[model samples]
Target: MTRLPTPAPEGDPRDGGRRLMLVEALAGRWGWSPRADGDLGKTVWAECAL
Candidate 1:
């Protein structure tokens, strides 16, 4: 199973950049690829198929 860092709100410029960097690091280091992602009111999530 792949693990993703808890997401940061995209509304903040700094957090948005940090979120992208985390994703990139996971992709580069572990070959993790996101299959889908979205916001659900109070919650947000991204999934990757193994």
Candidate 2:
């Protein structure tokens, strides 16, 4: 059986920022619709598939 790496915990500061940066980078790369706040909010409310 193959096992996947576990996702980062929600409360870790470094992991939290890293995930947000990745999301913003992907969004910029693909030209997706921007968030209503004009930026990726500190807390992501949804999971977007790249």
Which 10-residue span in candidate 1 carries the lowest summed lDDT?
38-47
Error of 2 at 31 (Å): 14
lDDT of 2 by residue, 1-50 (tens): 52322345567665434464455556533222335686743324444565
lDDT of 1: 0.45
Q: Model 1 clash pairs?
A: none
lDDT of each: 0.45, 0.45
lDDT for 12 (candidate 2)? 66
lDDT of 1 by residue, 1-50 (tens): 75644446656665333455565545533333454464321222344445
Candidate 2 versus the native: TM-score? 0.27
Clashes of 2: 0
- Ten-residue region with minimum lDDT total, candidate 2: 25-34
